[model samples]
Target chain A: MSWYEQYRSRYARLKQAGKPFFPYAVFKDMVVVSLILAALCWLAYFAGAGLEDLADPTDSTYNPRPEWYFLFLFQALKFFPGRLEPVAAVVVPGVSVLLLLLVPLLDRGPLRHPLDRPFWTGLGLASLAAFGHLTWSGYHSPLINPTVEKDPLISRGIRLYREMRCAYCHKINKKGGNIGPELDRSAGSGSEEWLAKHLRDPQSVTPNSAMPKLNLLDDEIQALVAYMKSLGEPFTAEAPKLFTQNCASCHRIGETGGEAGHDLSLIGSARDKAFIKRYIGDPSKTNPDSSMPGFKGQLTEVQIEDLSRYLAGLGR
Target chain B: MIAWVHERTGLDRVWKALFERHVPEARGPAAWLYTLGSASLFVFLVQALTGALLAMSYAPTPDHAYDSVRYITGQVALGGFIRGLHHWGASFMVVLAVLHMLRVYFMGAYKYPREITWMTGVCLLLLVMGFSFTGDLLPWDQKAYWATAVGTNIAGQTPVIGGVVSRVLKGGSEMGAATLTRFYAFHVLVLPALLAMVVLVHLFLVVWHGISELPERRLQDGDPQGP
Candidate 1:
């Protein structure tokens, strides 16, 4: 007999013996299943949704968060740094899936009831809880934006500077280290014209300046200039000298400094106190060419004042 | 119909002859465990039809992908619902496939000749995952781009061949238009072709080996198998 005939006869015998068969029993279930399937098909047919625009490679500003289902995985990626990222992203999730796939093999007992298999039931529940928790944690990431905003001019500028992460490359007073320059000391003696000129166009005065021309509006420039002018010797004397020494390896002033940055010879001629202060507060805002980092929160207001004074002093 | 079957005397007669000759002596109850394989097949059919419909409107280019998806969601008739069904169906297929594997495993169905069946099943599962990964990048949204980026980066960490694997998958150092094209090809062509082949082999193995009998005691006692 052909396989289909044999199968059909076997099914007939089973039906004759009062046992369920494929079409008789399975087909009933399939009716309900078919209805559900039809509903889904209808939904999809009527939804009228499609995809988005072509992806841009150069756009780093795109905040590509995962779908809600994958939020936990996205969140998990943040904890991993450098080489460990792969382990967190791939290995952990892969192993979890593998374990899930092996669930049948792992629980090979005859007991079908939950009460009969307490350990297995408990393990399942615990796993569910853990997954839920990890997913929640991932969805609400705290580290994505660590710095909180601060208010008032000095505090706000200082807060904004730190929140913006400025001090990484720039120096302030004799304290903040230099990826950029000594702003505290330079501003004290620096000319308003020189500071304004530097603020407008750093490359004009020094061809190899690490500082870029900050394209600030007139008002922002004035505010920053005022803040930098307030950083002279009369303001605060306790600026950390260690920061200057440590940072000077990559920074310079006038004719004698490091090769990593440009000469601040005409900084006083380039910009006013407020302009310099804002530049120090957020270098990227003003100049796209600036290697000099901002000093928003890394230093206190007193320290910023001292650094601004130090930079203002450069032209003298 | 019976007279027609008897008179055809071609492939139908051959099939009828085989069916009559190979009849088994005994038949048992139709167990729920038997439904799993059929359920998985049902899901695959659903995916195929829905995916084909989706393909009619989808644009594979990076620039147009996101906008096209948006248009489908916002402008097309019932487009969002269809996409949702496709999305949920994919999830359901994964769940059902896994459950089916588990059922087979618990029943000790992977012994002897069934090992090849089990191996093919594994490959099928992997193909489903491949489908998921490739389908995900087609949307070309923020979520799709970054998830794929991270996924490709993970692929890049595979030791000696990591960089090559990542480059091949992504088409470059970063996820871009090339990556989208590569994923689209895999999703629509490569995966479906492989799945169809594996499914055929799986069915052939099932027919050749015959349905596995329940344990002797369970068969005689006629009690349902343990959940």
Candidate 2:
């Protein structure tokens, strides 16, 4: 008899002597399904899913990360830059999937034991290891935009700013009414104590000021101060010259400059002013492997702020 | 009454075939490993239930989607819990599906008569990912917006048909109202039907071929010795 025929007959005999599926296999399935559902319920109750702010396409500083399972693919795409990015994005995954679909045909041997099919077994383990490593790397990668929404104080302050109709009187980023000074220009430059005092009683700092007393609690005052402080002051035109003098050697913005480092033309899209400021002060603090030297001591604080504000406004 | 129904429909015979049919015993850890497929099925059911509940409260539009999600999470009774289940269930489904595939692969259970089963399973895995990708856009939050934007842009990287593929996914040149409504239809209407059909085929094949008996190390050759 042919080996296929022999194998089929042997399998038939094995089934003939096997136990019924109803009580045995079904029981095991029930136990597992129950356990999984219980755990899922626990997670759903204790750790509910969170929602971020409304979708704002104009908020280019928002960093985009895929769900965790897809992170490995996202990380894998980083290896291929520019033109070849499509290969990592498409071709490699396409080939791997095609190969997976053809696995039965590829390893047609009748050996059912993994030990007997050492090559296939090893290949499976290697794939799993690669997947695990890629996922770990993706998880550990530094986020270009450390989320502004993560800070409750800033979020609350923003909410309060809207509730108090601060925009009705004070201009900010050139959007609010022109009755009061632009907060982006002057409000952020004040010391924490001064800003807090101003929020609590507006006329104290600037005599004959038209602003009214907000009558906010201390915590509310603190929150507004933090929010204002987080805003970037306007950068000087000299900011572009500073970049050309120092950053253009390695970084590329728009059409000109070297490409030793990443293209910073769209840097504003993923990173906000605060992040750029910190990253400029000390690259190692945020990204240890960064080859760029820190400009903390080399440049003055005002220069760094100006540079960050300049970079932060780029792409947006 | 049960007997009369059984006689009229041959229900007992069908039940016996489906539930009482014999399976070759899988020993110890292998027996536990067999539960992964059923576990995945359970998670799928959870997703379906929670997804349906979410749909009741959800408005699939750019203007209302985010607000609707917030309402469901904050106001609707037990809404947060249900949404949480759906969110976590997606991850659970992916993990369980991969683990089950690994079990089948390592056991060489996809051989011969079960090759069709394996192929259908691959389709189901891809379908699960489809479900995830489509379901993500339903929230219409910042993460949903930016992630989907990046994801479609990646699809646009395909060699020749890339632009067309991404446009179809986004439902236009840009991600907007059309994208949200398109994703909603796929997530709620299209993928579930495809997944259900594929799953039925997979289950049918599993029963038809009989779960391949645990491979014996000693029977490396085509030997017919009983364990």
Displacement of the residue B199 alpha carbon in candidate 1, Å: 1.2
For model 2, the docking class works out as medium
| Share of the reference A-B contacts seen in candidate 2 | 0.77
Candidate 2, residues B65-184, lDDT tens digits: the string is 988999999999999999999999999999999999999999888987789999999999999999999988889988999999999999999999999999999999999999999999
Interface RMSD for each candidate model?
A: 7.3, 1.5
DockQ for each numbered candidate: 0.18, 0.69
Model 1 RMSD to the real structure? 13.5
Winning model by TM-score: 2
How many residue pairs clash in model 2? 0
Clashing residue pairs, backbone N/CA/C < 3 A, model 2? none
| Candidate 2 TM-score versus the reference | 0.81
- Pick out the ten consecutive residues of candidate 1 chain A with the lowest summed lDDT: A143-152
lDDT of 1 by residue, B40-119 (tens): 88888888987888788889997577767767777777667767788777776776787777666545555443567877
lDDT score of residue A63 within candidate 1: 53
| Local error of candidate 2 at residue B180 (angstroms) | 1.2
Q: Candidate 1's residue-wise lDDT over A42-137, tens digit each?
A: 655664333433453433434565555556667676688887887876788778767655655566533344444567667766865766787788
